[model samples]
Target: MRATSRFLLIGLASLALAAPVSGQRSDDQILPKSAELQKQGRALYSAGKLTEAEDLFETALAVDPRNRGAFVDLARVAEKQHLFGKAIRMTNKALQLEPNDADAIAIQGEAMVELGAVARAQQNLQKLQTICRQGCPQVAQLSAAITRGPTVASAKTPETPKTN
Candidate 1:
């Protein structure tokens, strides 16, 4: 069997096994205030106001510490600020809450690449491969990031001393 097909079957089986019991809370439940804050944070982020977005995301987390959405948004803001470590950590926190979160996995992979953790990044890519099917956008995005490599800032040349 093709690896992709096998992976798909395994993923399906895992999902089946992980399916919540009837008495368990559904994933759809969300605190209204936290949801509103997350929405506002996303809007700010899209508008390039990363600082404001970060603040809103933090507020959301304060309101509902279990909100993986807030952690994911905070990861994005950290990435925008070039704080790759923070981004990875925040993504991890989100992943801890929701292991199959595509956004968190994708962002964490991107952060690993930025931090020059190629092996770890590859691991995340593999996880994505398992989590997403062929042609999935998250997989495509992480693949592109791995191919593109880390972005390096240009070093400024020092000024030469003037001759008398």
Candidate 2:
């Protein structure tokens, strides 16, 4: 009986091990509901309703964590709010979902420039160049952002009150 039980346990273990592992969904496999939310967010964004757009983008991400486009849209809203760090982080999430995503790379580079990380932005620009040898719009966008340089506020120092 003991031997039979041990054999059964081994068989069960083997069966469990043999079960197919679920692989990650591809970048294009976002759920329809999530995609719809992302579309609504984009329309709101275009309408200049950044807060509403950001909420919709966040909801889209909640619906499907793999929605890279929603992450990119959130990054755009963060950029509009002058939240460069948040934008970079959001773009990083999108990049993780699709490493070669041109929009994510370009947005990240732009945020880096806003944060005065010109060197890092240049690296992103170079990466975009390599990814889109045929010359995509992302390449031009990042290139123009690099040329435009960091914002004046990023370079300015806070004025200290005069000491008596």
Candidate 3:
């Protein structure tokens, strides 16, 4: 009876470990409510209501943290806010969900460019090229951003007055 109980305990433990793996959602399985929230967020973003859009995007993520589109949209909002580092981090989350996401790579590249990380942006561009060999709008967008270079505000530093 002792040996049987031990075997049953081990089996239950293994099954518990596997339960989470089974519960994990696939990349294609975004929650519908999250998608709806993301749609609303996109409309708000397009209408120049960035704060409202950000709120909706955050809600979408709360509903479904795996909503890769929401992550990408949040990154766009961050870029608009001139929060380049946050934008990069948001795109990194989307990339984690789908490594071949051209939009995420492009957005991340643009944010990197804004931060004056040209070399890293170039690498992201290369990755986009590899992922979209047939050519894509993201490729063009990222290329244009690279050509534009970093914003003047990002490049400039305030000068301090020298004390006698």
Candidate 4:
């Protein structure tokens, strides 16, 4: 009877070890928040409430320091506020966590464009082309930004009228 009980205990232990936990993410996955802070932050960001969105994203990060989504959203907030340097820094952190993060890469390219680093922005454009060879919104967006950039600059300069 003692041997049978020991075997039952071992079987129970094996079954417990094989069970998958429902609430926690795997190590290689992005850390999801226990609350909906990240989701709410994204909504605020979409509504252009940058300050509020930033606060919520920061709160989410405080809870999950490794939250890649929070880092990406914070980068978007910085970009919308024209804080190009801060955007680049935040996106870099997200990229470190997820090397192939499309949103982070796109935001990095946008930040580079605003900083007048056209050459570096092209690098990201090229990467997006390779990642989404079939074409993607990010590639189109970056291409448009690069194309319209020179026109915007030219418009800023007053053109002298030629004599008739």
Lowest lDDT sum, 10 consecutive residues, model 1, at 149-158
Task: Give the range where candidate 4 is weakest over 10 consecutive residues by summed lDDT.
Answer: 146-155
Stronger candidate by lDDT (1 vs 2): 2
Residue ranges of candidate 1 with Cα displaced over 4 Å: 1-28, 153-164
Q: What root-mean-square deviation over C-alphas does model 4 reach?
A: 8.7
Model 4 lDDT at residue 95: 92
TM-score of 4: 0.72
TM-score of candidate 3 to 2 decimals: 0.84
Candidate 2 lDDT by residue in tens digits, 80-146? 9989999999999999989999999999999999888999999999999999999999999999999
Q: Rate the local accuracy (lDDT) of all candidates.
A: 0.88, 0.93, 0.94, 0.83
lDDT score, candidate 3:
0.94
Candidate 2 stretches greater than 4 Å from native: 1-20, 23-27, 152-164
Q: Compare candidates 2 and 4 on TM-score and give the better one.
A: 2
In angstroms, give how far residue 26 of model 4 lies from its true place.
3.2
Ranking by TM-score: 3, 2, 1, 4
* TM agreement with the true structure for every prediction: 0.77, 0.83, 0.84, 0.72
Q: Which runs in model 4 stand beyond 4 Å of their true positions?
A: 1-35, 150-164
RMSD values for the candidates in order, in angstroms, are: 11.6, 3.8, 3.2, 8.7
Please, what are the lDDT tens digits per residue for candidate 1 over residues 1-164? 69999999999988888776655654557689999999999999999999999999999999888889899999989998999999999999998889989899999999889888878989988999998876478888888888888864323366899999
